[model samples]
Target: MTAEPPLLALPLHAAAPTGAPAARSFTTQLPGDPRALYLSRVWVRRIVTVLCWRGDVLRAVEAVTRLVDNGVRHGIPSSVPPPEQQLTLSIATDDTGSLIIDVADLNPAFPDFEAAVSGERGCGLWQVASLGARVTRFLPHEGRGKTVRAVLAPGPVGL
Candidate 1:
């Protein structure tokens, strides 16, 4: 059998000094396709791994997976023009060091927010909240769509 390729090591990112928050953000636009869900997970994992944040990377990946899936399913309108049938994913760190994950999509309606937050709706949002993320959403100033944002506390939860 052919030898498998050796694993590649990720470069080390210098840790931000204590009390000095690092502000960085990454954003990408993905088409409203089921395939974009996979891209979302990969994006979160790669970013988390590269940043070396203290929070659990898997948790972030899981949360992002659900959010992107929701955007692709509920946020993309079948009647919308092709140019407007995509969503935006963003990851950033706030001044308090919390990791923020935001997914913005074309549909402004999110009628199940309450149900989802309460676990009454099965959108996997409750699971994200159970992972210690504070999930919330807002409409952009232009009011074309909504953005679902989940903030993960710095460091792993349940400490």
Candidate 2:
């Protein structure tokens, strides 16, 4: 009989600094199975609602969906059973009036945002970048998986 693949794991950031404003974070682990994509979206929407973001829910949702989709598309090992893969989503607000969202996965392949847009099949990061927000990718370290973070702010002059 084939052995079941091991579960994918992602570590949460160490607790925030002392006396820092509470930045909320939520995490969900879904089996790498096909249904994981659908589960990820539901978790994302719940996180947004818990944060009480009053503006641009559509943009925020799109950003997260793209990130999660990228995780599923690039992070999972082809040989691993879908139930063995995992995806993690984290959201936080800082003192600078910016909301920072991070999506992490055990997959090691870094996405080529430029190439994706040029290829006409994926435009997730490009859309996030076009929002005038900053997006960055963090490589795995100390046995952790990769993370992609999107930093968004209320438009200048509070548009």
Candidate 3:
């Protein structure tokens, strides 16, 4: 059998807003790399800390970990011809005191959010959703991939 080409590398970039209550954004390519995953977690924690997340740091870390794991496990190609792929995570906070975390990957296969909940094969999204966060998926306008996003609100008042 013919071997598939190596996965194309995706560029990673990060930025923080330049105003009050700024937000941080991160982009990374997912190529089944362990280092990338670890780095992702580190950066996520850093962002959470910078944002002064006053409650459940562990839970936030867990959520981010699951998101990266899911991207590596299901977003990559493992069959006949593995295709080049990448994943990105972006975090930001709005003036209204809401934290938005977006995890995106290059998976053409539309993930069944519901099936993922019902079946044991997928539960990362479920955990993310269970946290009272909003999840959404969309196709990139200029690429052959899709992105899944999750938005979370900060803890209750007087946390």
Candidate 4:
């Protein structure tokens, strides 16, 4: 099969209005690559920017980059077909403007935060967990993929 095509982040301002609830969900398809990691971070920043929560933009970017980077590195096997190797990312905010980010890929090998957090400071998962986010859970979809989700609450709250 062929290498997967790239997925650029959608326009930042395309999100709901600035003062509106940042609750709308956005999804994008991604290929497995280094650029995917960088672009994913940019995407998170842009989304948070639209929500008028510029403070959490950097933290959100770092957290999302770590999560999506894990997906690219561990969630998709190189042997899988290009089409089958795709990753899907979903982002939204709750009524209170809590930002939620989810990244899914074909591998069922979900990132075990518990395993990664065995008191290790360097673990990416741990870094994500420490980002002042209220992590809901990691959910494995019925058959094809698993999703990792983290939530960062609105303004002056999320560091």
Candidate 5:
């Protein structure tokens, strides 16, 4: 039986008052489980919706899950998943006010964007890029994994 993993919710900081320089954001750390992916997707969608980034919800969530899937699959062993590789999902705005969706995992070997886009096997991340999610940057953890960040700008909602 799989033990339920813990969920960590950060302080709500998604929206800032007009003229404020620092934009708010929301963060949640989840386990490397399918259920965790679902929860994270829902939670992020809500934040995007509330922030009026309606156009970004679907694409942002899509990229979030794809990143989570890659993270869990490669970072955690299927037979014995580790909490150390817990998925971290965060939604915030950059200094420029663009919506940012960040997902991190304990995998040092990040996704190969070139292969994902050109090879048939690596279509997941390709799809993310195809949706116009700008891969902002990749931040390495102290000595373990890395966080892949993608940005989505507010626009018309997608059908």
Candidate 6:
């Protein structure tokens, strides 16, 4: 494994072109330690709650928990220094108003998406997909790491 470029913090607000939906996003980096699993869960729940998404908050939290757990377990290479092992968590709303949860880690390899979706692999991703989340992986522009993304319908609106 190679050294990962530091993740940048995106500004909270950005300009969107005409006819384009404005993006609402939040991002944070956490140590790639096991405790990140629990912290990710809490962070997602709080973000969803703040977004006023009451209907699917639990599902979102569960999905994030699994994804972050995967990152901490498989994405961290022991060859890297402890301080360098970090993961980024991002929550955002796409143009369609769906919730997007992304967990990025230093590993470029991805889980077998097809097998995980088919329940042939581990249950973590299977359960996430079963919750109506569209799970996918992509290499960030920097090419240092890959991000596992889960997109889900935001569910009913909250007051």
lDDT of 4 at 96: 72
Return the top candidate by lDDT: 1
Error of 1 at 22 (Å): 8.3
Cα lDDT, model 2, residue 60: 70
| Candidate 1 structure quality by residue, lDDT tens digits, 101-126 | 88888888999797997799884788
Report residue 74 deviation for candidate 4 (angstroms): 0.5
Off by over 4 Å in 4: 1-22, 117-122, 140-143, 156-159
Better of 1 and 3 by lDDT: 1
Better of 1 and 4 by TM-score: 1
Model 6, residue 88: displacement in angstroms? 0.3
Superior by TM-score: candidate 3 or candidate 4? 4
* C-alpha lDDT score of every prediction, in listed order: 0.75, 0.62, 0.58, 0.65, 0.62, 0.73
Off by over 4 Å in 6: 1-22, 156-159
Clashing pairs in 2: 32-82, 33-82, 75-107
Name the runs in model 1 displaced over 4 angstroms: 1-22
Selected candidate, larger lDDT, 2 vs 3 = 2
Cα RMSD (Å) per model? Answer: 7.5, 6.6, 7.7, 6.3, 5.6, 6.6
Q: How accurate is candidate 2 locally (lDDT)?
A: 0.62
Tell me model 5's lDDT, rounded to 2 decimals: 0.62
What tens digits encode model 3's per-residue C-alpha lDDT throughout 9-112?
A: 22222222222343444444444544456766667777677767654666666666777787777766664244445566766665655666656666768556
For model 5, state the Cα shift of residue 91 in Å: 1.0
TM per prediction? 0.80, 0.69, 0.68, 0.73, 0.71, 0.81
Give the clash count for each candidate.
0, 3, 2, 0, 2, 0
| Candidate 6: tens digits of C-alpha lDDT, residues 1-159 | 223223344632222221334266677787798778767776777677665653478888888888888889888888879979998888776566677778888998765867976679888888888888878777776647788877777674232
